[model samples]
Target: MSYASIGKRLLGLAAIGLLTAGLSGPAFAQKTIKIGNVEPLSGPSASVGVQGKQAREMAVEEINKNGGIKSLGGAKLELVYADSKSDPTVGVTETERLINTEKVQLMTGCWNSAVTYPATQVAERYGVPFVVPVAVRDTITERGFKYVFRIAAKDSWWVRDQFRFLKDMQDETGVKLKTMALVFENGDWGTGFAEKWRALAKKDGYELVLDEPYPSTASDLTPVVTKLKAANPDIVMLVSNAADAILITNTMAEMKVKPKVTVASGGGHADPKFLENAGKNALYLFDEVEWNTDVNKPGAKETNAAFKAKYGYDLTGESVDAYVAMYVIADALERAASTDPEKVRAALAATKLSTGPAMICSYDSIEFDESGQNKNAGIVIVQVADVNGQLDRVTVWPKNARRAGYTPVFPANK
Candidate 1:
């Protein structure tokens, strides 16, 4: 070979080597932010957990499609899900595994307060940024943990909204609520709601005729319903999960235990499955919900339409809350511009989302307080309404958020 040909060959080989390194450098440097998502996927709370997972998946998909955290060079979010089996201890164990074994930097969820309460402790101990979606126990954010954040309305908000709705009913319809009976599941979620309601009831000058707490796993609620029937209070306020909600509604209908007002402080009461299981029996039942599909909130209708089109069912409060949680985390990640847990925590604390898809909640905005609770978080009252021969969830209280021309048929006239 000629000297000129040999020099050209050498130059070509060097260029090829440099090009290979350039092509491989960015690919090797790219990072994926792993977020741990813990929920009860196989136990009593499986339905809610499943919906939450779907919401998270949808949010992550959307974020990725929109270029996946623009500040981080398009680093995609990788979700690591662990099933709590609807057990608190299991939730804690799964969370630990996700952090230690899976090496996830941030974490979200365990739908039930029982699971979230303990699971969040695990996240706190690990210094992982934990964002709670649907768990409403006030104590979840009261633990003085810097890494934990709750973006959903707490138990006190729900109970207070229930009273506000009661007052509205009396003022607008001349329905005097003299006495109330409290029946709740014996768990962190239920107990927190019951305690808040008790305090609010006293302050609001409402008489409490009966206070009952039952096991969440009980197969039948007849005993509790029997006691409630005997009390025959003017209003029966129940805090229960989906299964128990169905059982209570069925027992009440069968025994003809009718009250002037039957209210449920969210939890299972607001779940779409409750209506599916209770059918017409669910009519006239009032519920205090963090997010309702029928509410007049910005981006709610479009979001619900997309959710229904994708999932083939109406979006519930639990699902939407989880969806919002994902957005909050993505927002924080984008602001932090780094995967460092502490930086993400700080960014989350500084988050202020108002009037956008991220503000899909009932609240006007998303801003966490010192206690890691969303200060702007609020609840609205919704009632099962029959519209065009179909039972629909309709916002009926807080005149500002209520659907126009929709009147709640109290006492259901069944």
Candidate 2:
């Protein structure tokens, strides 16, 4: 009851409170960094989105196992998955939820360009760092949003490289491709790519015989193929997702509508499910893709093997892009050394990943430019080749990027 004794008791309580607060401060600072992954987990584009989710998860696991963001006191990455359901509206809603409700600092994995376009808008409004893994519509990066970064080649790049591949084919094998037909789904991705390709085809002196756009979820593509057959183009270029890609190929076979050359502008063509659905029909189908397993990039084989072991399927271009995006985010987080969105955004702007997991894609390196586009990223053309009764994707374009000992079977040969 003495005044001195009461004062001593108060001092002891204050010292204990300070000690407890000090101990919890570092524990709070070591909290996991929440990374949002928005994908179409259940819809027409579910396959692509699911693969992205898997790859993102694998990357997060690997980063955590390897000490995570070491600069952040070894803070582990916590991935929050939100299904866009392959719908643009739903994608925006989910992205907003991830940023506002889930409170994720960074986000990646919008497989469909349609989904990515709107989802990124939400991210920009909230000032969150949105890293696009697979979406390639040029406008995604052209928007001038500082928080948005795309690691894949844009639509314009893919179209230009596709024309370059055609010219290479003509020069190498003397296979003249004069006219081309374009068929694509009527969505942001398909329509945007088709329009770019049309311009590029004209620029390259190729006549656009048939330009057709169909619904993305169309059940049949017979009429489209019939139109393409009537046009009788020397080359048939398709901009479709996985389901539409298979449907068009099957319809073409059924109607006996064949072209001298068949090329796909990536999208669904680069998906593993495309091969599974098209089977031998996919042979000689050249596609301009962001990444291919055949490329002789360092760690590609190891990454593919690990992917197959975990997912029970070959790693598709989207999967690889998403996986690399995860590393890019991890790299940014490490450099930022904080989970603050602004710091992460700044770190992303200063990214210069060249030799490591971040360089697993076909790109020589990863570096974001003024518009948040990876300037070093490039596209490669790959042809589906039939080898010993089995189908294999063979890189055929950009001689330096092509896989050795792999020859493309021209349409004439097919």
TM-score of each: 0.91, 0.91
* Candidate with best lDDT: 1
Judge candidate 2 at residue 241 and give its lDDT: 78
Candidate 1 per-residue lDDT over residues 153-201, each given as its tens digit: 8887777778888887888887677888999999888888888888889
* Model 2: residues with Cα > 4 Å off, grouped in runs: 1-30, 412-414
Writing each residue's lDDT as its tens digit, candidate 2 over 107-143 gives 8868788899988988998999999987888999888
Evaluate model 2: give its TM-score: 0.91
Any runs in candidate 1 off by more than 4 Å, and if so which?
1-30, 411-414
Report residue 150 deviation for candidate 2 (angstroms). Answer: 0.5
Task: Give the local distance difference test score of model 2.
Answer: 0.86
